[model samples]
Structure formats: structure tokens, C-alpha cells
Target: MDRYLNHHLKISGVSQQLFADAAVTAIQQGSGGLLRRANHLARGALIAAAHEKNQIVSAEHVRIASTELI
Candidate 1:
């Protein structure tokens, strides 16, 4: 999972440790489905990053995206 998270973090440009850790935990603990939620979060983060014109995906973006999924 660490390898997966690291790869996504690099691709997502998420430099914040807190956001990265939260993302990892979200995927690890996803209730309905792990892979599905991970993909959702990753895709959402990428969208959020693009929308915000941010090089790094932020915790706020993750939070927003997760809430949208919920």
C-alpha cells in the first residue's frame, strides 16, 4: 500500500504529509470497497488539483472530494 500511495502522491503532486497520510488511510479503511474508494480519491484529487490550479493536492481538496463521494 505504501508503494501505491507513494506513486499516487507523486503523480498527484501532493507534498503535504498530512494529506498524503489521510489519503492512504482512507483507501486502507474504505468500508464499501478499498480499490473503488482509492480510485475515487485519486481521481478526485487529480480533478481537485486541476481545478484549483495547484501543483500540490491539499487536505481541503481531499476532504471536498471525499464528501462528494459520500
Candidate 2:
């Protein structure tokens, strides 16, 4: 993970559980946490991209990355 992303995420003050819930939302939305295996792959790719870019993680990135995986 990029230091920049970690810093912003810390500044955002979002809890780890909250992040988990977000993942849950993605799963419920058919983004593959529960059933769509592709979604998980996409998510991993998104994290890698964001980390490489040193950017804060956002929902848009998640959506785009997940769809891209599909």
C-alpha cells in the first residue's frame, strides 16, 4: 500500500469494520464478494492501482475497477 493512500485513509477516520461493510455492500450489489468471484479480483486490482498511484480509495474507483474486471 502507498504511504499517501494510508495517510489519507487515516485522515478520513474510517474504521476497518466500515471498510468491511463497504465490501459487504459491494457483495450485496453483485460485485462478487459472495458469488461473483470476479469482483474480488477486480477489487484486488483496484487496490494495486490505487496503491501505485498513491491515491485515496474511492467508491468510483471500486466500481470502475470491478466492472473492468468483469
Best by TM-score: 1
Cα deviation in Å at residue 7, candidate 2?
Answer: 20
RMSD of each: 4.3, 8.7
lDDT of 2 by residue, 5-67 (tens): 335346779433222334435434544334345336335545755666833434444555666
Clashes of each: 0, 0
The best candidate by lDDT is: 1
**Residue-level lDDT tens digits of model 1 in 10-32:** 77786544345655555455524
Give the distance in Å from residue 69's predicted Cα in candidate 2 to where it truly belongs. 2.3
Q: Please give the lDDT score at residue 5 for candidate 1.
A: 62
Write down the TM-score for model 1.
0.57
Model 2 residue 57 distance off true place after TM-score fit, in angstroms: 2.1
